[model samples]
Target chain A: MSGVFTEEQEELRRYARQWLDENAPLEAVRKIAETPEGFDAAQWSELGSLGWLGIAVGEAYGGSGFGFMELAVLAEEMGRTLYPSPFLSTVVLGTWLVERLGTDDQKAEILPAVVRGDHRLAVAAGRAAVHDLVARRQGTDWVVSGRARFVLDGHTAHTLIVEAAADDGTRLFLVDGDAGGLERNPLSVMDLTRPQAEVTATDVVASPLGDGRAGDAVDHALDRAVAALAMEQVGGAQACLDMSVEYAKVRHQFGRPIGSFQAIKHMCADMLVGVESARSAAYHLASVIDHDPEEAAIAAPVAKSFCSEAYEKAAGDTIQIHGGIGFTWEHDAHLYLKRAKSSALLFGDPRYHRAVLASRLGIE
Target chain B: MQVVVCVKQIPDPSGTYTLDPETHFLVRPDEQVLDDTDRYGVEMGLQIAQAHGGSVTLVSMGPKGSMQGIRQALAMGADRAVVVDDADLKGSDALTTAQVLAAAIQRTGFDLVITGTESTDGYSGVVPQMLAELLDVPALTYATEVEARDGKVTINRQTSAGYDVVEASLPAVVSVTAGVVEPRYPTFKGIMDAKKKEVEELTASDLGVDTSLRQRVTAVEPAPEREAGVKIEDDGEAHLKVVELLQQKKVI
Candidate 1:
């Protein structure tokens, strides 16, 4: 517990650090943020070629069949560089749900395409979807109507995995993004790095992934997504800490390095502590998810609650460390801050996670 | 076409290396940093193994920390690993390290052995050569590119003038220069796969290498801090000032 990464995992961290330095440089991220999909096909395809999208999926579905640890390992790196990709949405959320709960035919249809980067998909969690969106029986096919707000990568996804309110309680359905009655309006989000949208499904034909029982599947998918995002937050904190420390070293004040000052040193030290704390929690979540699913339930909420705020605090201090320059639109610090803010509230706020943690602890 | 890659684990040079103020020895941190130079050899080994239809075995002889580097190589798709670790091996010189590595590789069974030109901690590039001599194989050092086919290997030995194409038969050792091929990033799946991969552990007695009286570091000293140079303003007499300063420092 003293160190967050294992020897083999450290190898992944090094590899990812170098790869992100070369491929997902800050300038490229800034540029990519302006693109229609917020990520180009080539870059996404390149990640696919690297077998990233299939990290946790089974080999039968064209994945390498690793566990949550491997996924978190990459997620942290992706967050460090603010890598603008659909990895979190597609792999962590969408592909995860499909592979874990989808029928054999369902997995056969979607997972391989996701592995090859041929398909870009997203999940609108049933709990997150507006209750007005209802599933109705239309002859042999099911039709979904109403709205799914805050769908990650909703506009760019070729396919949508939506949780609809049906007679069978909350059910999960997969539908074409361009389904006749579906309208996707991309939201102007603060974190340009990760895009989102609102999907209005009016009589959109839907296919149930399996029995469509939301049950614990949605929670499991969300827990997986939260744990993965927690890693990203810790990573963002690491990035901010590195930047602040570097800036503190060179940015002198009173004819001396600011890093030499007690205030700056304490701030930097606190940032380090914050990041390492969140990192440990997130790593514990991943380890538990892989080894003990029941334990993952307890760890995920703590990870989410702590990590979201840690990233925000770390990013905020990063801007403060840079003084006036960090406030400018041209600088990268604001982008991180924005990402921290949006990510804090993406799945649910710290209050929500804390509530979840409290309930799990039987303290509610 | 089984390839064996020799790797060394070093503390991150970017971080401060503290001295065990009580003892004069450098207090090694628990941090695990793979020698950046060795990545090229790992990449080359994997490429050869993939192209020739065989596995790449990684052999490392260092502290337990060496598993950090070995695990990294395995994550990059090396088949398995052999770690020869013992507390007695500390302060052993290049020759001692090469002996342990040679013994480990003998057990691993490799047609070709790959190593970085030098390690970060000890830039003594002599170990690979010593390893080759111990194994009784041709040593190709500082190769910019390596190709394997038909029980033979060819390497482009880098030189100031140009690279020299050298061919060695199978069962050879090649020290690869960095930038042969961009080492592939260890995918998440690969890292997980590596965790399940077998790691054959060996010790001093297992390797039958007497580690007690080998070449030991007599003393360790940090490099002297560089003195700040005197800067002369760009006045008419700045050139004269430069000359005076140079002569004062005995450059004349």
Candidate 2:
């Protein structure tokens, strides 16, 4: 079937498929997931050299001058295979936010390095509710003291964006992992593949991205990030549903394939509905983020709510369809289920996003 | 040095080519490309120009719609492209097309020219020799291995029986068969770069070439349907049918 892409976009799709078949095979993904850093540096560098890392960045910043549509295509492919890399953290969140909020010097110094895949960044946005309400400050230098919990890949990132309280408002402060008075510790998470951590800052040295209106910039960045994550969730959930349907077609019960049974068929059909609905919401959210961020801010939470629920339902449905073998520790179904839950809560849980949607729309 | 590669866009030949019952002409979609065999010629010319530190210009003669073939050649590493588009040039026989191509090549003062031995449609495979005669230059046909070094040329030509390796000088034309090098797929970046490439268009008036050829497409009709052969279930049955058919035709 034809996708909603031009011939130029189709060329990129073909190139990416061929490149992955040749370079980033299943064995490569497996080996990288087994590594300490949980990503293959050499393969990341290869993608960077191939100009994929800069597909959406501006040409003035050494990018291809494309848009988020192209990046979304690549991200969906990555999610299809559960690519084991910090690509989401570095490429989607880190590089995207830096491009939007960084100073000219910051853009010149940091954008190229990230484009070259020399450094990785993880944003420490999710934290205790108290820190989210306001920012704290000190005498000559601003001292941000707070703990950010549930930071995605927080331990592995070289640079961290620590959301803090300032005298003016809530602001995002840049903190190095190895900076003085910063404590980085891993959290025991359900998803083993993508690790999370809690970061504590006690007078940590940080450079404020901007002096004023940093909160709004970071808030807009988070909205876009949530939209991207929703798209990835749709891909993951769809992959799970696909795998489950394939398994049902082969696995037999009472001398007949289970997929022929009405119960199994109905379950699979419901999963399809959830996946397609999530896809529609996710795609709609992506379309609005570029042209209209305010509308995107409202649509993003709605997509986040739907996608978070869809992935969790799809993952559970996939495990149930696999029956006895799925309950075993060796089975991979549980891994996907764990990832679904963890990913759903990465930016905001469905409930948190529902509340945000209600407040944004002035609906009580 | 300026090298020219003849590129023709034909329908994707890998798919089944069927004749319409109403039109005997080849059924081609309104799309263009560097014909499969001509892509090898273009790649070979690019290699020669790169080794000789010269320039390779791709030339394609078809409707203005055929400039897509030239752009594809440029993305395949050709330096530039020229297109000869004319309404009168359409439906010209092999001899007439060769005469116009010779005029276009002469306009550029090309040092060397390369082309496919045959187009998927025409299959005449006579343009190189015909153009060579018009230009009065040495022409080598069915070249499998071509080498150009220090202004000298050598080619291995495939003949009906065996092969003939011959030596030539500069300012020659070579029509190629496949087995030069596998054509390269355009990189993700090359698609973007091809948009900036320049393709010049020339008409028959610009070339001062006359369209007084004897043969022209007066009419077109579809050929008859090809019959599907009977499937033999076993090797013995296939051998017996083959022998019987040959015997009935009085072959042996």
TM per model? 0.80, 0.65
Off by over 4 Å in 2: A1-7, A126-146, A183-188, A250-257, A323-335, B1-252
Clashing pairs in 1: none
Query: Pairs clashing in candidate 2?
Result: A135-A165, A135-A166, A136-A165, A136-A166, B23-B221, B23-B222, B24-B221, B24-B222
Worst lDDT run of 10 residues, candidate 1 chain A, spans: A125-134
Model 1, A1-364: lDDT tens per residue? 2365675566667777878898879999999999878887897887887877886788998888767877888898899989988888888889988887788898899899999898988888743334367898999999999988888888998888888788868788899988899999888888999888888888999998787776787888888888889989988899999999989999988999989989888889999999988988998898888678789999988899899999999999999888999999988899899889988987888998889889988999
Per-prediction share of native contacts kept = 0.76, 0.10
Per-prediction DockQ comes to: 0.43, 0.17
Docking band of candidate 2? incorrect
lDDT (Cα, tens digit) per residue for candidate 2, span A1-364: 1344556665565556546755666566556666667777888877787677887778788877787767766666665556767777777777777787777876787778777777778887542112332345555566667777777667788887667666665676667778887787777766666766778778776777655245466667677677767877887898889989999999999999999999999999999999999988888787778789888878988998999999999999998999998777767677668778877887778999999999999995
Best by DockQ: 1
Q: Residue B55 in model 1: shift from native, Å?
A: 3.7
Model 1's CAPRI class is acceptable
- List CA RMSD, all candidates: 5.7, 8.9
Among these predictions, the greatest lDDT belongs to: 1
